[model samples]
Target: MADAPPSSEKSFLRRLTVITQPVLTRIAHGSAPFITTFALIHLTAPVMANLGGTSLASQVMLLGREYYQTPFGEKYLVLAPLVIHPLSALLKRVLAPKPARRLSSILSVTGYTTAVIVALHFYTHRVAPTDPSPPIYAVGPSELDYEYVKFGLQTWPWRSWLGYLGFTAAVAWHASEGMAIIWNTWLRSYLGGPPGTKRSRTIGAFLGGVLPVATGMFFMWREPLMVFASHADRFRAAFSMSPFYWY
Candidate 1:
């Protein structure tokens, strides 16, 4: 009887170790973002919804929700990438034990936590699977738009707004930092082994200056971008209750 308990504990621990092995490996590498565009898109789109000027949130919300109405969402761009960024976060915490880089730790932690939170919110608050998401300019009662409205209403306060703004800023920083690392570590070598310091600083400066401008453009013009996009794909995306492709 005494040996049975110890044996059971060992068995349980052995299973745990087996399960955590892959996660630990990923965390050690933290290269999950390298394969998927989720790292950048997740940072940019959600932040715009949270911090971009007035109309920006609504546009982004519509695009995101309506994306599900189409069949493509379940594919690489929408759902797949959304799910990957956080799931791939396993490597850092499991293998590293301690965060090696402060910036990376912050980004990965916040990204993982927020991804779960957002998923939960969608699970709990999202409309029916058959529900059609309308565009931002839709009139009448919006069955598909309620979830995003709720999200925006919750963050209306100055305090909430500031917190989200800070988070978005951190996301931008983390993404830019990642790109910088890629440039320094990989791209530098490809450029015939150019001087590291000058090129790196130049690239960093360019990214720093352009992030805000790009964000502004994205925030203000999501509708136009999506309109252009939907034309190519034939997905009906609009603010009305009966959007283009509600299937």
Candidate 2:
């Protein structure tokens, strides 16, 4: 039960970190665009709702879901990036020569937090209804429209409102910053940006785009439930599946 020599342990770690850095960085960066694309598609749902109400929103959501929720898209585009990006980033940070400061950076903080929020959202929307042990038909694809969001807000006004607002803001900001980083790092020459410069304009554009969606979603959440009322028991069961259920 003697410990391995410190020098040997340190040497092994150094080799592993050095060898993995580039690979991890590539994986993290490569998966970013897919996540960002989905984020944009997600933002669109609320905007459509704002402009044309739940009817329009449901149409848009279902259309987008047809692609991302499909087996191929879910595996390669949605689930893969969702798992790979954060995991790669986390491994990259842990393996970096100086990990302490890098892990505390805005990109790192927001990236991880956004990942958690997105996972919870996916579970509530996709996993809960289809759960084999107990089905929540109120939240199922066949019965639930996009306005199930309204049901959530109505059920837990403060928690739902705050959580949605924070999640949207973080996602919007993180995605904008991530895209800017990508542009500056790889596309500066082709895209006409100075290398090493931050893109406030990109951030501004993303925030502006999300603003309407946030407003629309907030109002939509506030709107009275038109369809969810009939399935009160199932709706409650669905809400119970939310990670924020206790809150």
Candidate 3:
């Protein structure tokens, strides 16, 4: 009798609820850590290298050495674990339940601890010093060596490598599991028209998670492999003159 309160009003309210639901869902899921991790990777990598021992140009050139020299950069090695480890821990918690919960929690603490230790190590040895001078080597002739291949090896010896190994492994696990969860949650609807129309979605998701992590593992393992192959000396020779060498 009152014109049914106008069908347009009812339709508008329905549309508003639908639009707001997803916004609230995203907020509830918490994207802060993800955004933070992305930001740290992009911003900190170059800055850390630049600030490692000298000016910005020196750091950028050092970063470029990875391409022609040994496929490793100071910023990459340092920031990767810092970013990936925590993200991995987060993903592990999100995707895996029972056993993963405990494991992820442990990794979260360990990752943060590693980062703190690394920061402290850098600050004490390199940053906090008043006189930051490059190292001089007395080999063959008194020449300035600007190769930094050995820089990676020197930073983490066998024991340090073991720590990095643990960190990398954790990252791999976390990334894989996280990918699985993302697929299940986001692409599940489009996976197939009907629910579980494609039963292989789980397997597909699992592989998606595993492959990228494996690539990361390959990078992580390269340093140790070079060390074990009696190539540490060569690396040292190559990296001894790195501009980033504060010690």
Candidate 4:
């Protein structure tokens, strides 16, 4: 007979489910897409900003800079979600006695950990305000005069490519896995079905396995991306203002 699950794992899962809903497995099914959607919306500001606004990452936030800063972004978006969503799921499964650990689980932990560290990094190593007087707000990275990106990519205090790759893997898996679950369970039901159809599983496999690998590889090859895009006339003309990013 198989050994039972660890007591701690059961307790953790129970507590987590209580904190979430009764359907612990389905929690990811719902929250993953919600979180990923919000996160994408939040980060898209930088891309939009690069296209439109004066270069400002602080503006990469939800509301404009009048109301909040590093503290708020770090807490609500990064820390709370880590606690509420991924960490709880991780503890529930990783601590279980059965089913030996897997690479997917390991990457999720690494990615979530990277998210926390990066959040804290932004809070602590915040860009200085362009103006230090009353009614002042902190400046964004692009707004600042520092060449930190080049420094990190080229010299000491290297950028966290490893952490970034982990983040990509984590994000890709969580987002795609959640999507796959919804597609498999919910959509298959719509078609009048039993579970575990080959097509549904095939879709799930693509989302869970293939997407993460592709995304991780992209981050790992980001410099090449920058280089390749650099030669494009449209991109070059648009981003010509930046010294480091001209590529």
Q: Tens digit of lDDT per residue, candidate 2, span 141-187?
A: 75666667777777888877777777877787677667767777678
Q: Pick the winner on TM-score between candidates 3 and 4.
A: 4
- What local lDDT score does residue 201 receive in model 1, on the 0 to 100 scale? 46
| Candidate 1: regions farther than 4 A off | 1-69, 96-106, 113-155, 192-247
Per-residue alpha-carbon lDDT of model 1 for 1-247, expressed as tens digits? 3445677877886677667755544442354453234434433444464375435544654565454435675455545655655554554345443544564454465555556545543442332223444333222223333233323333233432433344444444445544555555556777755434544544553465335534543344333332233322222232112211122
RMSD vs true structure, all candidates: 10.5, 3.1, 14.2, 10.7
Best by lDDT: 2
Candidate with better TM-score, 1 vs 3: 1
List pairs with backbone clashes in candidate 4: 230-247
Q: Candidate 2: TM-score?
A: 0.86
Q: All candidates' lDDT scores?
A: 0.43, 0.75, 0.39, 0.44
**lDDT score, residue 185, model 2?**
63
Among all candidates shown, the one with the greatest TM-score: 2
Q: Candidate 3 or 4, higher lDDT?
A: 4
In TM-score terms, candidate 3 sits at 0.32
Ranking by TM-score: 2, 4, 1, 3
Model 4 scores worst on lDDT over the 10 consecutive residues at: 145-154
Supply the global lDDT for candidate 2.
0.75
**Candidate 1: C-alpha lDDT:** 0.43
Q: Order the candidates by lDDT, highest first — what do you get?
A: 2, 4, 1, 3
